[model samples]
Target: MMVLPFLVAGWIFLVGVYGMVTSRNAIHAIGCLAVAQSSTYVLLLTVGYRRAATAPYFTDTPLRTRVVDPVVQALALTDVVVGATVTASLLALALQVRKRHGTVDPDALTGLRG
Candidate 1:
């Protein structure tokens, strides 16, 4: 119910976006993109968080007890997996670009104009 976590997530997202927008190198941009993706973890956790709530496992907890949303937690986990995959693919593409163009600078990759 706290607003601080949500604000923190938004701040993290904006920072990542700013870094991406200002990044000159492809690798830096990829890192920034990962940072941006990380904000979703914060946001998802915030959304699912409950004060004094138990884990989703109900093995020992009473049925009336509050528990965090399992669906949101699953979504967060899936987001992490997808983010890592996307980051890896982008890095591989960047490596290929550097190998072929001898540079990772977005502004210098004029060969991509075709």
Candidate 2:
């Protein structure tokens, strides 16, 4: 029960990579990259989970002292921002490619040249 999500996330990450590699269109490849990025987030959150740990936020309960790991959560937040920036940049490039070549096909865009 506890580790299932981790396993699933790992598989999802692999599948996303496969999709990205096999996709001919640049936009589809970018979508696969986003899926892979999401899998990393799932892995991060899954690894940070602890059984019987208290919520991340402070609580008034007298006996509850455990706190959810904040460092991993913060790292995940940073990763999300980085992924967003990368995706945005990639999409902009894809748009340029589409405008120049009239297609999003990476197979057709770059042929022995920039």
Instruction: Name the candidate that leads on TM-score.
Output: 1
What is the Å distance of residue 36 in model 2 from its true position? Answer: 0.7
Overall lDDT per candidate, in order of appearance: 0.95, 0.86
- lDDT by residue (4-103, candidate 1, tens digit) is 9999999999999999999999999999999999999999999999898889997888779999999999999999999999999999999999999999
Position 63, candidate 1: lDDT: 72
Q: Which candidate has the highest lDDT of all?
A: 1
Off by over 4 Å in 1: none
Please count the clashing residue pairs in each candidate, in the order shown.
Answer: 0, 0
10 residues in a row with least lDDT, candidate 1: 54-63
Which run of 10 residues does model 2 get worst, by summed lDDT? Answer: 105-114
TM-score of each predicted structure versus truth: 0.97, 0.86
Model 2 TM-score on a 0 to 1 scale: 0.86
